[model samples]
Target: MTPTDPGQQGPLVEPVPGAPAAVATLHDERALVIADYHAGYEAGLRIERGVDVPSKAESRRERLLSLLERTSVGRLIVCGDLMHSIGDPGGAERGELEVLFESLPSKLSVTLVKGNHDGAIGAWLEGCEIVPGSGTRVADVGVCHGHTWPAREVLESRVVCLGHEHPCVRLEDEVGGSRVEPAWLRGRLEPAAFRGRDEYAGLEWLEGDPARTGSRPVESPAIVVLPAFNELVGGTWINVAGQSFLAPFLPAGIARGEAYLLDGTRLGPYRSV
Candidate 1:
């Protein structure tokens, strides 16, 4: 639970312009947050898709370092997918992870919310805190990988930051060509969708009255679905017909979700955009 000292201000979550990252301001410290780093993605592409490509590991590390400097955050939170392999990470991936951590400022703390692709990561990575895939609270905000139902405590936050869907949208040009761009999905949580689920069993609402208003059963937290930090990864084309979400509880877990581009362009309703 977040502290409620009358003297301290609440945490604020703000996305970085033109980047797949956000800055979360806590009472005493700020955090740089991102999702789906997918380290060593090039090797995965070669093994799985047979597409040989050059590694962008150094570039990724540099970009993250730049964001850290720009945001001047004291901590870095990776929502999930810090690694690309589902099993043991390859040599390249491990090396990339090592160099990335070594490059960080000595005082900057790191947190990794375990994701589906992060099965093999553990204590070997120094200076990194690995939390459960369900989620964890940082002040008033909840951070999760979004592949499964979040823990009850996480659901109770004022806002929730999630990844794993790698949301994007298909845009069509006047010449009949189409391009896909990374997108952000913003919405409110639906208690009914998660109330009786395993992760949310025995949960109780402390705010709002659904019986009186005929609206949501409880006070819902704002949900922010972040875009993948690695531009090389494929994502769910949210507005395209027949393109479904990857998260198990998404589309149902979120209510009235609207899509936005990385540049902060609101595309209106995701279904109609």
Candidate 2:
């Protein structure tokens, strides 16, 4: 489906060719949007898997800086997972973030939609806008971290963007070799899954709000699930059997899910791909 018209709606998002980022226009400001940065991920790998690899913080920072320059966006919107640690981010991770932010133009605004991995980021980060993990609505676009149900306001937008699944696909050749590639998942929201009691519990229907009582959702916004910006992290293999989505509302919330490669190759239905 086509993105919301830039002239009619106050927001528009266009994915950069061969890139993990998208340029979005929110109101009058243009922003570069990315997700699951997972800064200092190498440190996590060392601690969790005993793989002591050298840090790639400089490269990650430079990559982001290059994107900002190429896109010429005035704002940066990180959907979530700006930090690798869930709590008490140490000096290295915090230092990487500081240097990264310092490297950006002083005029560029930054917005971080707090993710499950960013529970304590605010304790050290500064000068950036941090929205609730439930989600936030900026103009006609909705953004969330995708670990839980988005706010009702976010669900009602013309389009919803999220990360956390870090979706990927496995490609196998006739020679029995295979490779994993990052992928983008796009679909329309299924109203039944969000509204039904059994499908997802504790979803706020806002039934107590007199204005919203008994009022079904007015729209089924298109949903865009982003690939992780950090390549070192693991991902959910959407095309693999027995693989399940990490988001609580996903799989059930999506309709006609389609996958696309970073180079813009359409892979048709994600399940079949």
Candidate 3:
């Protein structure tokens, strides 16, 4: 059985603008959800990559604060990759994250859903709740950083949210002008195929009225892959010929999914392009 959490009952889910990127909000729980902050990315820019830019952790924190102020939400859920490095948190990485948290409201709760790059991130996130890299349930939605198979709780949710692929669409005009835009990928689960997966084998879909008897049981779920929140982060050009979805659960169905700009334009299924 999927372990029950006290916070995963009812939720009002929607997308909200969170500055350079967007955040998913669960209105019922007063939470703002974001993914892939990649806190130490600036170091890579300045040192390894030989870019002249100085660290801008303070500026990023300010932008995040502005989004929080606009929404007035009490919970911040980072759906993974809070740090860029795939190893331990270094002093620079730790310091920047501390500054990020110090600027936030003291009353707000933060949850970190571990992503592939979030190794030892818990050391940097002192007071926040840390869930497994697999996933965690919040307000009836299953959210993960999209590397490994999510725990059963997340698998059984009506809506499953993912982040790691940093999904984007590459577009070229007939005259050769091209642009790549970070985007959301929305798609449906193929029930027969989804049921065949080892991870979801015996799990049953149990939503709807408990008092009513003999209602038909159902399967299939809507999958939503979020764009990377940091504008600096690169993306997977999903529609390109050799490009592919990264998450294990996504490879089978991602080609059938439609991409959407943050502004909400439907760009059609990835495979069709």
C-alpha RMSD (angstroms) for model 2? 4.2
Residue 83 lDDT, candidate 3, scale 0-100: 83
Worst 10 residues of 3 by lDDT: 1-10
Per-residue accuracy of model 2 over 98-142 as CA lDDT, tens digit each: 999889989999999999999778877998999999889887789
Off by over 4 Å in 1: 1-11, 201-218
Model 2 weakest lDDT span, ten residues long: 199-208
- Clashing residue pairs in all predictions, respectively, total 0, 0, 0
Which candidate should be chosen as best, given TM-score against the real structure? 1
CA lDDT, every model vs. true structure: 0.85, 0.84, 0.72
Best by lDDT: 1
Better of 1 and 2 by lDDT: 1
* Model 2 stretches with alpha carbons more than 4 Å out: 1-11, 197-219
Q: For candidate 2, report its TM-score.
A: 0.89
For model 1, the run of ten residues with the poorest summed lDDT: 1-10
- lDDT order, best first, reads 1, 2, 3
What's the CA RMSD for each of the models?
4.1, 4.2, 5.6
lDDT of 2 at 65: 94
Off by more than 4 A, model 3: 1-11, 17-28, 46-48, 205-219, 254-256
Cα lDDT tens digits for candidate 3, 1-273: 011121344223456632333344453556767788888788757656788666778777887788788888888888889888788877777888888888889998998999888887776578799998789878567888888877778867766777898988888899999989887777765554455567666676523333574666554556777788777888888888788668876667432477777776677776555
